[model samples]
Target: MSKKLAVVTGATGGIGAEIAKQLAQNGWRCLLVGRNETALETLRKSLGEGHEIIVEDLQDERAMAAIAVRADALGGTALLVNNAGLNQMLPFENTPSSMILNQLCVNLVAPMRLTQALLAQLKRTHGTVVNIGSAFGAIGYPYQSIYCASKFGLRGFTEALSRELDGEVQVKYLAPRATDTKINDMKVRAMNEALGNKMDSPELVANEFMTLLNSSARRRAIGFPEKFFARLNGVFPELVDSAIIKQLKTIKSFLGTKESSL
Candidate 1:
């Protein structure tokens, strides 16, 4: 019999690697996708057995098509973790046009297209699609405007897909709060520190993510207060506005730092 196959984007490191590790530990074969072949190979080897690797830039328009063909070669996929994402911290005015477009493409459009491309395989295998969104997506943080917009778009896409494919395939949206990864620049880290924001390590999140995947729940928000705030903001945007408005000074302090904004 064939092993249960899983495809994970952004699988070379950080949360994506951890998620893939946990899935493999639970007996799912992995197809790791990322931009670096060496990194993908490193992760594929670390995963032990029953795995493969695909080196492709998620920013490319052809990525969805390529990922679909790779999935076909695996027979089909049992799970699709759209874990690839771009995280940046910068003021709206400082963000370059090219950077803005790339952010949306990687964080929002890529997942949307990937899911569309893999819908047939997902339906046939009763597969699950896990979109890794952010608390920023729900609440729209001060410095990361474009990042927030992309996540918000992703959140909406996930919700619509869940409703559209409810019984045919399980679509889930998992929102994680500030995570400890290279994605966070030192300036961003300092702001989080100043604000006393909680940061979840990739391992801790991967563990919780696995639990969420096993349950019947269609969506979940990781981290308290962030989770609490996401729901609260949904019901009362004005209340959240009042709260976030107070953080402008702190957010501005980190804006001019020499950070990649990626």
Candidate 2:
């Protein structure tokens, strides 16, 4: 019998790479998908064996198609982690048209396309789909309109798909708040620091995320106030709105001169 396979997008760094290592340790064949070939090779070499590297941009129209063909050749994928996403720190008004489009394409569209391609294989194996979302997806934050939109869309996709596939396949949404990764830019980091927002390490996030994937939970948000805030905001929008309004000044202090979209 062939080993079960797990596909992790953005596998060259941070939580994506950490998740790949964890899955490999769990006796699963890993497909390291990323845009950087050199970084992908470096990570692949560090991992033991039964791992394959797929260097491709998640934004590419053909990437998911190529992945589908590759997964079939590798004896089918038992797990799919849509971890490839980009973050920007500009205010809405300052956000460029191109950046907004790119963020939408990478963070939201790519995951949908990739999952669509793997649905057949996932159904055959009772496989799991994990969408890496964000705390912003739950609570909209300043200077992250585009990022928040993408994550929110991802969360919705994961929830709808989970019900749509119910007994056929397992779908999970794992949201992490303010992860300490390269995904955070200098200004973004400064804002988090100033605001006293919590940041989780990539490894820590990956471990917790993996645990949820292995369980029966459908969706989980990481971090303290973040998780609490997400729920509170849902039931009491005015409460969250007032709290966020108070932090607007502090959050905006870290923004670059050009960013003023809020």
Candidate 3:
């Protein structure tokens, strides 16, 4: 029997790495994509044989095309996990235009472009496209305006794409709440010191994501409180905004001073 091919972007990160590992364990020949050659090599070695690693920055359009070509050579792609993203906490006005562009490119554009590039192959296999979004996508957060915008765009894209590709492909948006990845260490510690809450663990988030992957659910939002708040915000916009504003006042106290411009 031929092995299934799965592609995961940002495969060096905590959640992405775990997803690649889990998928490989599930009998898929995983194609790990990331900018870090060292980390990718490390993960490739750990995953042992069938798995392949592609060291390419998703931000480069040509590189994404090359990824599609590589997957095609592997007997067509069966799954594409668009998990590459960037995030930073900064006041909206203070965020540089370049940073905003970079975030949009990595978080939104790359996924959309790569999906477009690989659509034919995925369709042939009746494959799935998993977009790793964030809870911030559902609701706006203070000091995360741009990040939220990118995620919101991603969610919107996923919803529309899921409907458009209803018959040909499975499209899913998995939104994970604040996870205890390296990205959140400092912020988590500060939040814990002030707001009395720490981020969730990456392993926990990864497990939730795997559950979503196994289920037929079109949208999966991790973290109960965030999910509830997202739903409430969707229904009661004004009330939710007011409540979030009040909550942000407290959360901001824990955010600490801006260390560097995002």
C-alpha lDDT score of every prediction, in listed order = 0.88, 0.89, 0.86
Badly placed stretches (over 4 Å) of model 3 are 254-262
* Backbone clashes under 3 angstroms, per model: 0, 1, 1
Estimate, for each residue in 1-262, the C-alpha lDDT of model 1 and write its tens digit. Answer: 4378898999988999999999988889999999989989998999897799998999887988998998888899889999998877866777899999999999999999888898999999999999999888899777788999999999999989899998999999889898998889898889899988989999988998898899998888889889888999999989998888787777777775443333
Clashes counted in candidate 3 amount to 1
Candidate 2 residue-wise lDDT, 42-114, digit = tens: 9888888778998889889899999988998999889999999998887687789999999999999999999
Task: Give the local distance difference test score of model 3.
Answer: 0.86
Best by TM-score: 2
Q: TM-scores across all candidates? A: 0.95, 0.96, 0.93
1 against 2, candidate with superior TM-score:
2
Best by lDDT: 2
- Candidate 1 stretches greater than 4 Å from native: 257-262
Candidates 1 and 3, the one with greater lDDT: 1
Candidate 3 minimal-lDDT segment of 10 residues: 253-262
